[model samples]
Target: MNPLAHLRPALDAGLVELGLAAPALSARLLDYLALLDRWNRAYNLTAIRDPREMVVKHLLDSLAMAPFVGDETLADLGTGPGLPGIPLALARPGLRVTLVESNGKKARFLREAVRRLGLANARVAGCRAEALDEPGAYDCLTARALGTLAELVRVGGHLLKPGGRLLAMKGLAPADEIAALPPDWHASAVHALRVPGLDAERHLVVVTRRAA
Candidate 1:
């Protein structure tokens, strides 16, 4: 019952086409999914338990923005089950990812997963964004299924460097939220992305800091 047999082609094609990691990264992703599904039972990490859906909804959906991640450090805001953050980090090993969650149970799960998965670059922070001391220090920040664009920007603004960007993973286009962006920090570019193995509804909202 090797999941990779069914997943390899679609996963490879998706990552390669999306410009995520090389096709080889898919194997690691598959391995990671196995662990996720096992932990999910006790941890209640994610709702979707099916491997296929996990690949499409979680893994591929996260990699849609691999190109934009570039060399900057990334933080996952309000990360509950590590959808876009953990998957994104698994896909792009070179990227630095901080998974922020206020829940003690989820944070403990993430820490255990990071250690067991040998994810040296992935870290778990059990705190609200405002409580952290570092401000305007991150190269990139991300919020997946966290909150409205305005709210995320307001709370997570201090996490981004002066010229860094914020990547928001959303289920639909955020027109009203985009409109409400602060003029100085509004999006400089908005890219409508496609995740190869995921649902068409997936979108990556990129907002870079605009100069005043």
Candidate 2:
């Protein structure tokens, strides 16, 4: 029996709250969480150790971005342990996701997760966002706790095709970071996200290149 099985109710409730209730998807999310829990004991891939907290902070928090996602090729830059990338892929099977991570251990974990989860639409980049060579290849890019808006664009901007958007998950509204955005890019929209079971504030900053 999976030790994390007890948290299934919480995960299901959170998914229903997010309007993403699906039995299969929720089960897969739990499987990924169990895998992460197992790996953390040996790799320390993430700091959040409790499985219940992982359902809220990791699974629900990541799936909260589902409504904002579209059917486009997405690159998840600096995806430590495949937060939004993995969950988003699991939620929307048609959306193609590329998990970009430079850390060797984390990258290994990501690849394993993708394979074990049978994520046919997801792949791992296993390189730094800036080092990733597929220029102007993606329709959108996502980052969670990666860096400031400016810093994120500086590193991963090349991955976006023309008119592509960057959906950045941040804690609180990063006004300072928004103001620091490069001249070529602008915050097209800012959405305050409410993750079920989470008490803190979360925001999604959508950025796009300036019209030439």
State TM-scores per candidate. 0.89, 0.98
Q: What is the lDDT of candidate 1?
A: 0.78
Tens digits of lDDT, candidate 2, 14-129: 99999999999888999999999999999999999998999999999999999988788999999999989999999988899999999999999999999999999999998899
Cα lDDT of model 2 overall? 0.94
Q: Spell out the clash pairs found in candidate 2.
A: none
* Candidates' C-alpha lDDT: 0.78, 0.94
Using TM-score, give the best candidate's number.
2
User: lDDT, candidate 1, residue 127?
Assistant: 94
C-alpha displacement of 77 in model 1, angstroms? 0.8
Instruction: Please provide, for model 1 over 1-212, each residue's C-alpha lDDT reduced to its tens digit, 9 standing for 90 to 100.
Output: 54445877777777777766465577777877777777787878888878778777778877776777755588888888776778778767788898998988888878877887788888988998767667877898888777888888888888888888888977778888899988766766667778775556756787877776
